[model samples]
Target: NSTKPVIYPFNPNFITDYKGYKLGMSVEELDKLFAFRKENKYVNSAKEFQTVTGVSDSLLNAISPYFKFPDWVNQPKKQYTSYSNNKFENKKPIVKVDINLATQEDLIKVYGIGPALSERILKQKESLGGFVSMEQMQFIWGLSPEVVENLNKHFIVTAEPKISKVDINNASVKELAKFPYFNYSIAKEIVTHRSMNGEIKNIEDLTKIKGLPSEKIKIIALYLEF
Candidate 1:
């Protein structure tokens, strides 16, 4: 017998257009959030939400409890003390990681990366036959720029992959397509061009193929040897 998993309650921020209507907000009040969103600004606190929306106290009280903010915004404000009555500061330095060498455990030790994302990083690295540059990490699917910044703070690319590259002039289309950067169409184009032109002399030759852009030459070059 299949059992349904228990669903837990989650915070609902003023996300969709429906929430304001359901919560009994005035059209003018609801429009404020949409206007703010259009400007790419956020009402990070309940007070800020009220300030933006001009909601009455009763309405503010009803909705304020459900307002969710980012962790940085939620952090308590620091209090200053006199030098004579100084408080001790205790801190632990964040450990650095080598992106090329980090295991799942090491990846997880970074604040934001959980098990699934760590696994994905490792899997992408493995599929790529290991990363050739720190910049290459940007290509990992689902890694946001913010997380990439965090990863960069803690990690450095110290090594390049030692795997053998394909002989592009001789490799079959299917073999070339097996590489992550090349789909069958591009691979077929490469092979057909090589056959017609006699041999692909270097990565620059790929730029001559129609629809295969120069940016692709950089990525596809990683797996190809002249």
Candidate 2:
């Protein structure tokens, strides 16, 4: 007579190679799971685990009962509450300010933006003469997507700044490199392309330049005069 190995509840997110083998997961399935985990992601549910590892439904069903996630994952979601009539009656509507004109004080009001970040934003704004588009906000170092979204809610590009547009056809590598979106390598590529080909006619021509960031061609076009 022999005793059977006892299966214990465990978080699928923390599965090890040995643990996966004990759960009867195939080497291929374990590899897939390990790959997903390597990306610093977690399998939130048994279904998600199967989706990530391509485990069979039968195998998932067999082991799902013993799967234990964190208490936060198991907690019941709070019920949504309806707002009272007076809750928003006294609140004033938000008036968006021009991003180009927004001061450090104004920028600091947004969540996640501190003094240093606000100063950086102001510096970036000043460096470009002023922001021609709100999209430029994404280029600011340390600005997260969530903070960008918040910034968008409180700012707009109502005022367009007067910019000294770069002459893409005649600008040297050093001159082209001055553009915020471009680096020395990209600037050199542009100069080389201009020398090989005739004058760059328009934004479409800039796209043909090898090694130029195709995604930022539109933004770069904003500051270029062909």
Candidate 3:
């Protein structure tokens, strides 16, 4: 007889179907429904409600219209906590990071640098000889002072860059190995080959050693100033 939703006065079972809505109920009944629903909040949608409550799709839809759902129903409202007065604001500036003296691992502790930017800082330092000042780091295309400032938070430059000499003609394996990145094997091969073949002509001569690859030589060449 009723194709559209059949409206009824109210049945306890029938009223439980609506997401707790009771259209034709007394105030006491409505209050009871509200209180019962408050204590026992249940899902109300066709897809999730049936899976959760084992209510059938048609029956769930039919029952949902009666009850007013819970207020804390949807996703939670995000509360923004104020951090304006936190200890981070009160942090003291103890030292200034000397960009020239810092390593890639050291440089990244500056606030905004991730692994990539830290490597970039190292590579840029290599290319430009070395960082003469904090300002020189900005020459890197994307390295900004604001980023440096955030990073500089815990940084302090304690040492100055020192000049060192390397003699292409006479650098021994042990002496060459003292350079930051030169390995024992590479340094040994360079000195042994040069000792047999006579003096090294230019920095490029070291690249021709049997085990010493050109890429490795190029990397070490940047650190050598003779």
Candidate 4:
């Protein structure tokens, strides 16, 4: 006659493949738990374990009683509150810096920016003379909307850089392509339109040019003169 295997208290975080089989956990559930553990995360509670492994309620009830978590996991987290008796506490106000004047050090201080990204931002700013608006930051590759939002919190385009505006009416396709917003194709289209019609005057005139980016007409307008 075969004797029964002894059941003992265990940490679910350290459950091995063989041990998981004995606990009646499916292969997929065990794989999920292992994958979660590979990320260096631990399930501190039975509910969390079920969440990670997708275990049934009955199995969770049967196994959870035997789950032995560390003492710290069971303790309530402490909260500290600050109370000041001084009425004349001086707090320094946060000052937003001009993006045109921001250094590499300043750009990297924002949460999502690293060395490579900071360098790219500086290069783009240098190429464009300097950023004219916060909206221009959206064009920087690899910057997520959240990162851009964070950048807006710390930087603003207060000091406009001195940029020589291009004459759209007189500029060649190559000359027009030099602008940050225009590509070779769009530049060629502008030149073709100017040749076919009279000189392109304003944003409304640009809308008539086929293959021109309608959305960027406003931004492109900033760097162009009639």
> For residues 74-139, could you state the per-residue lDDT of candidate 2 as single tens digits?
342221122224667437677999998899999987766779889999988776778888887776
Query: What tens digits encode model 1's per-residue C-alpha lDDT throughout 3-114?
Result: 7443232233345666677677888988887876554355667787788888899988876776666664444222212322433332445666668788888887554576
Q: Report clashes for each candidate as comma-separated counts.
A: 0, 0, 13, 0
- Per residue, candidate 4 scores C-alpha lDDT tens digits across 147-189 of 7888998899896689888899998889888887778998998
C-alpha RMSD (angstroms) for model 1: 10.6
Give the better candidate number (1 or 4) by lDDT. Answer: 4
Superposition TM-score, candidate 4 onto the true structure: 0.58
lDDT of 3 by residue, 2-109 (tens): 456555433232255242443333345445545434433333333443443454456656655544443333322221124335667557555765677677777655
RMSD of 4: 12.8
Clashes of 1: 0
Q: Which runs of model 1 end up more than 4 angstroms from their true locations? A: 1-95, 210-213
Best model number under TM-score? 2
lDDT of 1: 0.70
**lDDT computed for candidate 4:** 0.82
Ordered from best to worst TM-score, the candidate numbers read 2, 4, 1, 3
